[model samples]
Target chain A: MSGIQKNIIKTLLLIALFMLSENMNAQTCCAAGAPIGSYLEIQTGDKRLFSFQFRYEYNNVNRLVENENRIENDPRTRYGQSFLWKLDFSLNKKLAFSAIVPFVHQSRNTISEQQSSFGIGDFSFITQYTHFKGRFRSLNISAGIKFPTGKTNHRADSQILLSPDMQSGTGSFDFIFRSSASKTFSSLPFLTSYASALFRLNGMNNDFGSTSTFVGRQFAFGDEVNSQIGARYLLTLKSGFLTPDIGLKIRWANHNLEQQQAAPNSGGYWLSLPLGVSFAPNEKKSIAFTAELPLYQKLSGLQITTAFRLGFQINYTFQKNKTDDILN
Target chain B: MKNLLFLTILLLFGCNKDDNQAQTDWLIPFDEVLDGGPGKDGIPSVDAPQFDNVSDISFLNDNDLVIGMFHNGVSKAYPHQILDWHEIVNDDLSDISYALTYCPLTGTGIAWDRVIDGSKTSFGVSGKLYNTNLMPYDRATDSYWSQIRLDCVNGTQINKVINTYPIIETTWSTWKAAYPNSEVMNLTTGSNRNYGSYPYGDYRTNHSNIIFPVSNTDDRLPAKERALIVMGDQTKKVYSIELFAEDRAIEDTIDGTTIIVIGSKSKNFIVAYEKGNLTEVVAVTDQLPTIATDTNGNRINLDGTIESGPLQDVQLTTFNSFIGYFFALGAFYEVEIYE
Candidate 1:
């Protein structure tokens, strides 16, 4: 197969791997992925339930603009890819640790394409505390910082990765903080209403891309902060042994960096809704899968990227109380 | 109690009601809602960059002009929104002369005539913020230091604001003077786009500042503290930026994480203004800079940074080609000094 076809296949496989891992185990308090249907598990006080999870994905970096205004793909630099890995550990019902490392493979392409690429992508680490049941339903809040651990060079701007042209890392440090509130309801025998809103804070990342275009040097990515929030709902088949689920989500985000100058100071709202599914062979090991397709992308015209992320997770339930998880 | 337990169990294993349909698409465009012109909000109605002549400050073309140019087949003057905000912004390479004049802090475009004063050439932020300059036009009040005029801003003796500077020279004169030390480069010679004085070469990180003159004094608006870059769109459009820093540094105030912006006292990060839009993306640098000591013996980071693009004759959405990415459609240069 041509390199472009292979890359598309690889990207899909990576998504499959990510989704499968999310629900591989069902009993752990913090599975490989977040709770499939938004069942908030608050650590109100000292309720000890623990687990660990991780996710890794790599996207073949190739950008092609179609004549019909559609961005296309090229096979020459098929090796170019975006590699990302996530590690998560739940201390108990109330706390969790998150770490992510992203890499922009500049040398993956032939020497010709390499001439325009830039520096390495960065890494992020965050740890949050969950207040199982605070004032409302289950609420979770996490705060952490993103460090510029990747390389910074303008040598990689030529890649088809997406804009704000971050080939590698922009040597500036960024801090990220997120607060989330969720309430899940069993509205019907097989339906669950899951809603959660997150407030995210982003710091500046100004290593400047490979080119001296005015935007890169504007800040360090310059000192700025931005926010994004999303909410989702899922449907499940609560049968004897296997529990399968499906759902949707909506998200709104805004950003104001030293860049995006002509845009509104605040920003236009972006809305995204995803349909997802979750299943469990048994209570001890539960599985969740999801696909996020942007309903509307008004903010960044990163078009030609008919992009969607498929995620899967599995978690093993620990000690159970009643008949269901107890017997398993 | 049994029902409560059953309810909890149901809640944990219930299904979600959202759809998972799949389809392919680019970003939705706002051309229709945008109404082919500037919005009442002093900004483009659509956030995305417009490539045709349907917007302000654009080049002249039936499809490109939002309001047709002042004269056909010639480099036209700027639109009111562009002019109202930025009174003068100069580029030293192109035959046509443009001045983006306005102040985010002062909240006015200043004035045009040298007598009005209080104006300075508005340049783009350093990088992709929206690069709109291919050369530098020395600016002060509405008047620029003109190599075009031998007298300079002698017309305005008004000390009230920045009412004086030098007269802006034409492209040939400006480059002849700005780069007298180095081999001069001019993109306007091809005769395809012969308006304004600015350079357009291949995509790059470095080019001479092709600077002419803005005003007499620094205008007290430090380069770093001034507005970010503004890049032009295909439709004579401009994308603006309002990059803000903390109002006060740690030395200026006590313990605080306040964003620290340009105006607020407590200090904070805020978006104070917006400029042009980015069509194509590229950086220009004579030489990349790192932190170093200045000739004045002060510790500083001297970066030969310049942001420029819009590779002429290309649409913003149509910029996915390697050739388009590398071609120098427009030019921009700036020397940033940070301590």
Candidate 2:
């Protein structure tokens, strides 16, 4: 069977596994996720390549605490699910382009109240340059911009503007910078490792005056920094190869400012462990899945905690000289 | 700056704007109701409220505001500090379902019967404000009702009049003093919110700054003037809280229905009751605030009891009255001020 057909079967199996696990246990709660962590492998061939990736993430926010104590008598909780589609184009060995499109659904439940929202989320575009390549390693640097392309004025059943966190997008411009490096061990050639750091500088949405129920006229989100390191070892089989990976990710965010004032319960830090697997039936196609579980979390104020973050991606590489490319 | 402006234009045109058309017959124009904040179900209503005896409430200060209700032989209190955050509470007392609503903007506290056409339904905040008053939507039919208007302005129950019950907007001290055994809502509301501070900064004290606009304003009273309001079948009347504080008693007629208003501003308690018979009234006691006197020379107590007349010990029937800012009354009614 071709790689595409084989990856499809593996994708279905992973989905079944996720369903079984989800039905067996409930995840813990907290919130915060962005489209990230793909494109770690830099292309080396002379032919241009195109890759498509999809990711699903869930964040649960339950506790709104102050001073680490759960605030009593207010039961406003939210769960956010996001689906992201990313396209990457490696035009040559030195240059690449990428874009992320997201859709989000948020559900809120109070003591006796519940509400939900579904819509397109923010979109991001990025450009990258490969600075160096060696027999065993590669280095790349990237810069990106995110546009406020989603609805920010969704209302509750009460005809009030939803809290900023519940909306599909932040309604702000964000600038992003990232650097990544990957190395293969010649002594143990089956092992490959990579590390990356990403930073986001957020802008403000000044339209909260007409859209907000609270007193704030403007809403500005906090800046964010994320660092991740992972390693994978390949296991060759008769039909394909299986790469099992383990990673650690750390995220830090500054407190969000509202109307130029520090908004309460708005920022925090999280440490997570990512466990993943990639199945490659051939070089041109692969299916990968990752599950992230937070090991430690300390928020500056009360916030919804993230129970687990899960991602799935099916990557297909199209080579210029391939039969598929000629047919197209 | 040029790059920023170009990006801003792209951002503005990239998303779809919400355009919901009016679907029901409205007493006021739909544009009059503006967005308050928090998307739909953003400020969730308390579905299952927890309660404790008045003595168990240690968080409430003497002057902290609370909405008091006596229904089906039960007395319950909902604090403004709590209601300000949630907006609505769907609760049942002695098997009768009721919705307790408070609009911080209009300073109106009302308890509504949750039954319409013999069916029980609950309410949620519609995230909408009419004349700075809360507009609640019934869950069963998704019809939006103006709290002050007491009518469903849109949706399946359009133009439907909601049944209202009586509640007293008073201070915590006054409510506890009167109904010492009453059940006060507990602060341990299984959610997260600061139950101590008012969410809207300095709103209770700010009189001149109107954040949301109302269609009409009556300069007869200050915009935030608190008053006792009585709603009859066709007419509505207001007894100024200041007048109730000064006279300690107000006897008036609305559309020929005789009513008496009494309360203590210092004590933070005010109530109105329907009068059934011929009456003469006077304020005779300084120590206890015994203000009512009948034609037959009987002193009546603030609890509507006739003190010395032939009908001594007889209690007058209390009306379903509530306290509101004059601005809210003007927003909903052609109100007659009791002279």
Q: Highest DockQ among the candidates is held by which one?
A: 2
Candidate 2 chain A worst ten-residue window by lDDT: A23-32
Worst ten-residue run, lDDT, model 2 chain B? B1-10
Runs of candidate 1 with Cα error greater than 4 angstroms are A1-52, A56-84, A103-121, A133-137, A157-164, A168-170, A184-190, A206-255, A259-267, A282-288, A297-307, A312-328, B1-339
Question: Roughly what TM-score does model 1 have, to 2 decimal places?
Answer: 0.38
Interface Cα RMSD for all candidates? 19.4, 9.5
Positional deviation of residue A324's Cα in model 2 after best superposition, in angstroms: 25
TM-scores of all predicted structures: 0.38, 0.65
lDDT of 2 by residue, A177-209 (tens): 989887889998878787889888989877652
Candidate 1, after superposition: displacement of residue A247 in Å? Answer: 5.7
The Cα error of candidate 2 at residue A308, in Å, is: 2.4
